[model samples]
Target chain A: MRKLTLPTVLLFIALALTTLSNAQDNIWTPETHMKVKRIGGTAISPDGEYVAYVVTSPVMEGEKSEYLSQIWVAAADGSFNLQYTRGEKSNNSPAFSPDGKQLAFISQRAEKPQVYMMRLMGGEPEHWVSPIPTSSL
Target chain B: MGWSYGGYMTSFVVTRTDRFRAASMGAGLPNLVSMVTTTDISDYLVAHMGGEFWDDYDTYEKHSAIYHFKNVVTPTQVIHGQNDVRVPFTQGQEFYEALKRKGVDTEMIVYPRTPHGPREPKFLMDVSERIAVWFEKYLEE
Candidate 1:
């Protein structure tokens, strides 16, 4: 055992106090809400080549605060990660087609929410419509 | 098709199509007007629904599953948390009762002390098993 000097004891107390204060500063609060990142709604490609998920962060718009959500794509092997969609409104609920050639998701780019399909290779997402009106369902 | 919102979708879909043999609705809202009154976000619902129940009764009733229950032929399994406040337990109860009264095959599993969704391990397992059993039974037929 080593002898405890007065300065050494004081030094250990100071370090402990610093850590406690730092932890207190990191407590959850409305001000720290923006610093939090929420991740959810995962959709894996049929071929298992990529994983699509939503990442949301709080945003302050004029007088209101709302979440800004965007879809992110990641390689199955964890080699690459990138933002998949860049729309002004929130984009989420990703679903890949059975053949893995197309990705479908819901977006509000057209004022009303609609299903948009995009090729995994690249290109702008196109609105997917069925032969029958969805409103009839 | 949905969890909370999906449950609502499943409930609405059955009234429109009998193409599905079996469906499971988990914590769904069947009555939009009642939902607005009961939900914690009453003001938010009023804004989303465009107005209060009295202001736009037809719109709320038009989208509500309760009004369309007469057309549902598909067998449905309604699962809900007894303590769910967001969607409330009454929604599931009302749907189940309507199905029963109509002589449609239906079952309701209300997990005690559960909210919105089953978070406890035991309740989760119960829900999974019940779902699997319900689907398998319908598939076998």
Candidate 2:
């Protein structure tokens, strides 16, 4: 066996710890560089068969950039997740109403964060709640 | 957690602060992942001794309720762990008091001798059940 120097042991330990942390963080943070990683919204479909969520991420451009978010949905079993939200703007927190026919979420499409709702399958956006404080004096 | 009000993905968080906060508050929100480490990460956070990610004003006070807690709405419940060093017990109290002042429906519970996220089985069951009940009561019409 060869003698191991103290520094060599320290270096080995550091490398081991670094590798361990990376492995752990990867598992904790699902996927890579998510458009939106934080909690935005969750909705169980009226039939309880589908779920939708809002995801946001920052996209860097040649100059100043802003947060971009969209709505993504998947089956209850985690299948067929697709981006349902449009526009390159920021959106988040996609939630299905208890009735399951309508979906609600927060968006910055108008340049400020506020909640909005849309049909589960298509067309026309309705403003639900404004982030503008109704009572914040 | 079942989605923090301030838009934090406590669901994705893996820290002691998140876990104990979940448990102590009786959150039924499932824990996807939580750190079970040798060093009490709570203490590390309490000491304010970790590398700061929320250093920039926007990040640190990302809607910080610190020192100013008056705009709380909705009936609220606050739960805390005595041994929680991550967010510290003080923050909970501040929140609790704020909700109380506004007279929002609220309740507070503190677990004794539990860290941020104790693996104690009973605590897990308690937290989950409580959260479900709370949602049913408040969110469900």
Candidate 3:
């Protein structure tokens, strides 16, 4: 090891201080928190070929911030991944049929959250079940 | 399966239908009456439940999944955080016990030091992998 010179030591200190200051400048903020995407509600295909899950992202509109959750499907072998749902409303609770050809989930597109079924081969999601009216509850 | 509201949906849907071969419920509320009293957000649950559970006992019972457990035939895997205050761990326990007693295949896993959901990356991955395995086991006919 070489003996450290005063000038070299001072140069190292300066670099360390600069890095610390830069880190402080990049401290976490509310905006930073909002940018994070969360994944949940995972379901596996019957054949274990694909996994369906929900990705929740924060949307900032004017001064209001809202979360938008959409279903996503990915191959279990990590071959391909794709978003299974879109639009402004939130969709969640993905479940696969025993046949592995269809996916069932809850969507908030209607007045209330309803169950939807979509084919794996491709096509639009079908609104399947609507909850009982609140009046009955 | 799902967490929080999604968990609630899983429990509720399983009671209404037997389409799914297997399901994993994460921090789900199966009993609205117990959930309203035990959850941290009692007011929110009460508002959604239509009123105080005591005031509308019939309505609460009718809406709760536990009341319709006899109709559930699908095997369910229940996962919950021991420290969860939002849905309460007892919800998962109750559902699991009910299914087990009914001879409907069921299992419950409790994670210590966790809240409404698993926050650690390992716990999250474990949940995903375990659920996948559960579906595979039951879906295989």
> How much does each candidate deviate from the true structure in C-alpha RMSD?
18.7, 21.1, 19.4
Please provide, for model 1 over B71-126, each residue's C-alpha lDDT reduced to its tens digit, 9 standing for 90 to 100.
Answer: 99989999999999999999999999999999989999999878999865445546
After TM-score superposition, the amount by which residue B139's alpha carbon in candidate 2 deviates from its true location, in angstroms, is: 55
Q: What is the lDDT of residue A94 in candidate 2?
A: 75
Per-residue accuracy of model 1 over A73-93 as CA lDDT, tens digit each: 899999999998885687878
Query: Tens digit of lDDT per residue, candidate 3, span B8-31?
Result: 889999999999998889899999
lDDT of each: 0.85, 0.54, 0.87
Which number leads on lDDT? 3
lDDT of 2 by residue, B1-141 (tens): 332222123211322132122212322121111211222353443244233433434433432443223433445556656666544555456556655677756676666665554333344445555655665675555
Q: Which tens-of-lDDT digit does each residue in A1-137 have in candidate 2? A: 99999999999999999999989877622124333345466767889889887775655555434456688877888767777787867677677878777778777678566778888777677998757563541
Model 2 residue pairs with clashes: A35-A56, A35-A57, A36-A56, A40-A93, A41-A93, B20-B116, B28-B128, B75-B105
Candidate 1 local distance difference test against the native: 0.85
Going through the candidates in order, state the TM-score of chain A alone for each one: 0.80, 0.60, 0.80
Worst window of 10 by summed lDDT in candidate 2 chain B: B27-36
List where candidate 2 sits over 4 angstroms from the true fold.
A1-40, A134-137, B1-141
